[model samples]
Target: MPQSETGTDTAEPVTDHDAQAATDADTDGSSENGSVVPWTSITKPTDDTETLAAMTAASAAEPGADDMADASLPLDQVFAVLKNERRRRVLGMLKQTDDKLSLSDLAERIAALENDKPIEQLTSSERKCVYVGLYQCHLPKMDSMDVIEFNKSRGTVARAANTDAVYDYLETAAPGAEPDWYRYSTILSVGGAAALGTALLVDPMTPLPVIDGTVGCLVIVFVAYGLGAFVWTHRAD
Candidate 1:
């Protein structure tokens, strides 16, 4: 210790290592000394770090991720969701629109369809009946499965990524709009049987042999139509 003329002790200078040790001790996550350096200042994260992190979060938040998540839900669950005719009707209405609609508006329209009246003619009771079921049950359940994005607070309904799986099982056409395949098939069967019977009864020299190939062609058309219908209904699934 060096004493001053006034008999007070003078303080010694702090070495770089001592100051660094003080800093390192205060820092909770700084790295230790490297090969030649005694200590180094830790680099703080820049804005780029936050930017990259936000980018990663956005990518994970994409609709594709939600789609994949919904895909993991069992198909039986989806079928259960569709089991209710009201829910099916809800989905149908949503499928028709490209943008969000108010819950009140949706309920009113559905009520109109069910009541066979225009929306203007819908009674308060009719609207409330559909609205209550949708608000309390259907929309929440569908939203839970990620089938639709239901903003309960705002009362807005919008389509979501999971629509395809449920929609695939629905008849897109309006009631009675589709052709009567049963009737067509029946006519073909009657025609085919009569021609085959005629070919059998007529002489082989009377051009009746051509009926065999004609019946075969009709059979092929029937099979093709069946497969096409199957494929059409099950597509995009």
Candidate 2:
């Protein structure tokens, strides 16, 4: 009878040498050194390493880095330092003007512009009117906030609070803005009055009787003028 054709009996078995040869081939010749080098074990972070190195170099290259360590302040300080728009405009005008303007002169210029007349043609009264109005009205409020100073002798005044910083900020922020002298005059004048009031209140030199009599009279006059201004500005509105 013919031999049975079972598949298990016909299978071939591998020798030990063949198995060793197969292992060597699988390792790609690394097995000869008694250690197999892993093909995908560790990788160099070329892109990431280069980025980190670049950032470190950049930080080192910056000048005054140590000096600028305190550059940023808390939000409260930032808000406190910022000036209002009107004050900023006044500072800018003073910075750009070669001849510092007196309160009257500044107001005259504005009135002239509004009236469509030449600034040079404005009469003394027109100018003084602006000055008085501003001194008695606008300036006190601004002075209360410490935005400017009035020089009683020179008859000239200047920006008092954060003037430089405010101007610098405005130069970048509002390059096209021009000073509104009417507004400026008012603010400065009121500020001056406030200063006077403060001096009287603080210094004992101010005569108490004079304050109740002369100073009181002046205050009444100022209040009256201020009321007129309010009405005028109101009607115009």
Candidate 3:
């Protein structure tokens, strides 16, 4: 209205307005980018769900096992086999006196004589040494091509080198000797006989019906026989 000659009026300066608009836009952009703080400077939460779940999973996982282990079978036989070691040092120690070695003593001796260096370095070496003796020393030798005639029940023992042509044929056909079938059969037979004997003894003293005691004893005997048969015929693959 005042500068009518140019048909315009210079009401306000653009510099201040433009600067204010830029400052507001920058504030909004900074908020959009999360924050003005550097990435490394930000504080992470202590109880993140993903991290907690990962930690729990790791805690729950079972530890890995060592590969050099043998199948755990009859404890006494396994113990005997493991007792046969390089130079039979362990066996000799046991034979010097019929003393059962404590875990600590066994570990110390085995660590002193172990073939594997990593095994020797173990601080709690007893467990490892026992494992080696049982699996590596005993089982393989027992399973080998050599003919070993050992009585599990009587503790009778003998060994002979494989020279027979028929021995080769047997080994080739069976791979391993058909696992001590006679021993298992004998065990089952003894159990069955015992059950029958118990049933007879109890039947005389038992009350009302003869059928209950008879049937129970029969069940027990049958179960024992079944278990024995399974133990004998089954081979670990």
Candidate 4:
């Protein structure tokens, strides 16, 4: 170097004072612009975690899953309650009303349905039959299974949480002296059997062909009718 460059000869070191000044400048710049920027910009990174934690806490504070499970009625109990016609009628009555009923009122309604008579027309023994059955047997049984609430002391009854389950199993109408379709089908079967017997009797005389085929057709019709009747009788309302 013929002549050393005076200012460039040695570079100035980055001292702590300069570094602190630069940091303070950055802090000041952030504070100045902070008012214009959204708070969301500052808080966004942790927002997801905070929201997730809040949701988790809320769910944990609710009733446990077991509580929901316990509210549902058991299938066997539903079937058991439906096995008796009186209990099914009781459920039907309760479903129609929103209020609790006295056992006497419930029995009157059930007795009317069972006897196919007006409540006023029901004989004392008829009423008593329903009353005793409900008070001592049906109501207690349903109460034990949570199908209905039976207040023994108050002599009141009301639908419980599981009452709907019983309703699901109730027949729309009582099996009712065999369905008309069933009787008609039975009559038709008898007619067909008589015809078949006549045809067999005359088969030797007339030498009719395809008697076996006719028999097969009759069998198919009978089986189909029987299956349909079974399904109709057993089907839910």
Candidate 5:
């Protein structure tokens, strides 16, 4: 009776014009001059650009491998240069005297020291041995480490800017000196440990039940002794 409602119902059709209008509405929000602009084109970095930026950031974060090697070179050179007795003598001579010495003078003094003779009394052979070694080998090596300035043409040598680095490794004791700082520090540490142990056993302070004064004193003594020994051993000449 109601005109067969289900079969008679009608609906609007989606035509090409309607579809185009919907598309325009969707793109218009992001369009300028009737052209859609992609957000990625403006905001996203290209692959090559991103790779370069990553590389730059990495470089800033860490030192190059060669830099690490260079930093370690000086200490290694110091040890290597000091291993030879002649080189050690050269450094000693440079350190002791304020004036720059001629290469010949340095060789003469070192030869005399080596032979246990007066410089004036050194044999030509002994002097020659020292001279050749220093001139050909030791001086150049020291110069490379910046421990000494060697002017080959002038036949002169003097302390250089980094001489202190070499001096740090040099032993400070004079020949046949009694009880060097190292030995002295060891003895002091042992004595201190013993005295603290004895005091702790005696309980002289009558420590509280929960807090042992003797044990506390012992810890303090050992810490202080260790720090003192470290300072004594590593102190500059």
Candidate 6:
């Protein structure tokens, strides 16, 4: 470089980048003309391919949905928690009560339903089994999702704000209101009887070509049994 007539060394030519750098340095983060400056500018969205572009576009479009990502449990997590029947029942119980529950109390209620007995009739083993499962597996998983606030120190449980998301898909019977498996057993027994009767009561009169006994007996038994079951099931109502 050579000195100019003004006695200062010849200065480098000013460029657009130099002016921009000087502008940034003067305001720190404030923009020129007193406008607000963005902390980040997307100069190269193509760096990350379409992912960054799509995300940036979405974020810019839906400013109000910023919290939507965290609004509910993720699908994989929700499905994992929902996969277990016991976990679903736990949510149902919490939704029904809508308050904190002692571990022992919760276990007793679940055990009673599981055993199809009253709370007073639940055995120690049944209660213990339910308690252990909740404590060891289910409770931890739900706590991770923050669906239930589980205080491990106090052994207490309460519904969390995010519980509603998971609870919406859950359906379960409260304690003392389980389905009657015995009724299903009756259907199985009747079907076996009907098949046995069909085998025994071979109707040679209608057995011209294809088959043996008449299906009328089977149909009659099913209709009669269905009526009886309907009556029995609705006895309380």
Q: How accurate is candidate 1 locally (lDDT)?
A: 0.78
Q: Considering summed lDDT, which 10 consecutive residues are worst modelled in model 4?
A: 28-37
TM-score of 2: 0.33
* TM-score result, candidate 5: 0.44
The global Cα lDDT (0 to 1) of model 5 is 0.75
Sort the predicted structures by lDDT, highest score first: 1, 4, 5, 6, 2, 3
Per-residue lDDT of 78-113 in model 4, one digit per residue for the tens? 777787657777887787799999999988888877
The alpha-carbon deviation from the true structure for residue 165 of candidate 5, after best TM-score superposition, in angstroms, is 0.9
Which scores better on lDDT, 1 or 6? 1
Report the C-alpha displacement of residue 52, candidate 4, in angstroms.
5.0
Tens-place lDDT digits, model 3, residues 1-237: 355767776688669889868666645334456554344345566778898899989966845331112222334544344333332443344444443444345445656444334545656545565645644444246545232333334333233232121122222223234445455557767876676677767777877555566667767876877786676544321
Candidate 1 lDDT tens digits, 1-237: 766678866799999999988866766563345432223344554799889999999987877864765676689978877777677778888888888879998899888776767899888899999999999998999999878899999999888767777887766667766455566667878887887777666747685557777678778877987887666545423
In model 1, residue pairs whose N, Cα or C atoms come closer than 3 Å (at least 3 residues apart or on different chains), thus clashing, are none
TM values, all candidates: 0.45, 0.33, 0.20, 0.50, 0.44, 0.50
Residue 213, candidate 6: alpha-carbon lDDT: 34
| Count of clashes in candidate 6 | 0
lDDT over C-alpha atoms for residue 211 of model 4: 66
Q: What lDDT does the true structure give each of the candidates?
A: 0.78, 0.56, 0.48, 0.77, 0.75, 0.73
Which residue pairs clash in candidate 2? 134-186, 135-189, 135-190, 138-187, 139-186, 139-187, 139-190, 139-191, 140-190, 140-191
Model 6 Cα lDDT, one tens digit per residue, 1-237: 765788766778999999988777755365568774655552334557678889989978874532453466787787778777677778877877856888998899888866778999887888999999999989988998887899989999998756877766665545446447566657767776767666665544454431233355556666786787677655522
Lowest summed lDDT window (length 10), candidate 2: 66-75
RMSD of 6: 15.0
* Per-candidate total of colliding backbone pairs: 0, 10, 0, 0, 0, 0
Model 3 worst lDDT run, 10 consecutive residues:
162-171
